[model samples]
Target: MSKAKPLSDAQPTQRKGAPLPTDPGQTGYGAPPPAPLPGAPSTPLTGTRQRGGARPVGWNSPSSRRPPQFTDTTPAAPVRRLPQPVLVSAAVVGVVALIGAAILGYRAMDTFDTVANPLANPSAKQTEVPLAPPRPTVTVTATPVPDAVRVKQNGLYKAGKVAAVNCTAPAVKPSTEAAALRFYQAILPCLNRAWAPLVRKAGYEFRPPKVVLWAKGQTSCTGEPTDVAFYCGDAETITMRGDQDSKLFRQDATSGRIHAMDTLAHEYGHHVQMLTNILISSSSRKGWAKTEPAKLEESRRLELQASCLGAAFLGANKTALGITGQRLETWEWQTKHSGDEYNPKKVRDHGSRKNNWLWSGASFKTTNPASCNTFTAPAAKVS
Candidate 1:
């Protein structure tokens, strides 16, 4: 027709619901074109025509083909990628923060322990860490000494009326070591009788101290040579160098008996300190002192109190021991001489000669232990 159009130039008739041919060279009219085979090259589009009136948006014309529509129900595989350097830096920062937090927590706990138990180990080595100042030790009920003894160091306690002592003096003077030993042994019974009731009245535990008259030996308490008379609270023993003490007593003609009696009484005063817990309290104070000067002052208080107690005992039984006015004067003089003035370096620990005389004289005029509270006395009085 119309001179019969050539087949190559003929227009193809389309069927309903059939896909249109995309290539000019393709022959399909009604059926869909064959799908691309696996690994086969894609056929190029030769026309701008689609089933619609115009090409769809995002579709290129002619040689460029529209991408195949995917109808697969399975999800695509996620792309695998290395983490960014910035993200890696963030992870490293998080780990460092955790480590720093742990170290700070540990240090905070250690500081708390040190502050809570200041007395647990005071000699511990110091560190650069900032810490709170040490606080004063609280007086607890668990302490070895009685509350009265701890608080009354500066006051008086009425030890009650001491009865007259029934003691007969030994005939032999302390001229020889053996004679001195016998003389001290004889005097022990009188001392026990004089001090026992007073200690009992004060509601304290009491036992007669053991006496050791050694010529040349070391004491168990200090492991030091027994060159002078001393009372050891650790052993509850009174040790006297019999050879040396005998010579000391005999050297002074005017007050040989007074010197010997005072020496023995002074050592016995230490026994009273141990019984009443004075020694325990004093040792704690001295050990806790933060300065050398404070420590020395504590020592002076202890020694001066002991001297006062010794005079208390002597005054309570002065008539029984036949201590006349001249003997008393000699005793006072000897007490003054026994002060720290004899040794320049030891002055701070034993008080001045005037302080020793005042304390001893005060006790000699009173029967009350309350007057012997040297701890509460003014610094000038102690000095």
Candidate 2:
């Protein structure tokens, strides 16, 4: 033991599996390595030793020991702590929020559509709903019309030219009565049809009048004597004696004779008078009732007007009623004869022969009722 002389005096040397010591002023192969720690200065140099110096043992600290080599088993780095439950909860919460938002959005859309556009929801509107208010009811009444003459009892009559005959004994017969009655009913419609437009134009609704006939030597139920055909303005009725047929031997040509047709036509004209308010208004005028000279002329003019209106009714529809020109000639003759009932010059004279012929001719030529106005026409023209 060379008396390990004095251990302190001698320099230490590295041993196997041991780390070399470091000096402050001395350097190793490159820069001087770090000083070994007090503990484990060379704890395990079993793997590999530094080529030039002693080594430390810790892996993170700077060590002189060779880096530990592993067969890919060492963890590459400290694993990041992953809170799986917390992450899963956060993801689920986000998805739940999105679903909630989607639900809320759909509900908002539905509410907007319903409130904004009601008509777009036909199905919803179709459902029964309360009404705002109820409806009201109303009623109406009608007026009664007058009755016309029965065609069975009284025969039809027309306006026509004929010679006065004795209808008293020989002419009285049931066949003639039946024939006259048939003729009246058939011809009255014709007269109405012809005058319908005139009356309507004059602001009236034309209605046919009643017709009644009495046989020869018979008194009317009202005690009137058998006489010529007459229109009752009061009852709006017509009364004709059977004996008058002898006096006026006129009748329908095709159906019976020209006389009966003319009689009914005249009576229908009277009915037109009533419908138009002409008879009442004209006859009741202030100056009309007075018995003055001019007033008498006015009466004649009034009657003449009635005559003209009658003629117009018959002649307006000549072609449609199967009236030939020859029949028109017969009409002129009839109007002249029948118009004599009123004296044209007297206060009551409707018209004279000249006036009757002219009025009838004017009606035959023109369908216009305005043209038949006898009031404003020249006296000469009226005649």
Top model number, lDDT: 1
Q: List candidate 2 segments past 4 Å from native.
A: 1-175, 214-226, 246-256, 286-288, 292-295, 320-322, 336-348, 378-383
- Candidate 1, overall lDDT? 0.66
- State each model's CA lDDT, in order: 0.66, 0.48
lDDT of 2 by residue, 133-217 (tens): 7667667666632122211111111222111121111122224555555545555556655566555654567566766665556
Q: What would the per-residue lDDT of candidate 1 be over residues 263-331, giving only the tens digit for each residue?
A: 677778778878877777888888888999888888787778777777877887887776768877877
TM-score for each model: 0.58, 0.45
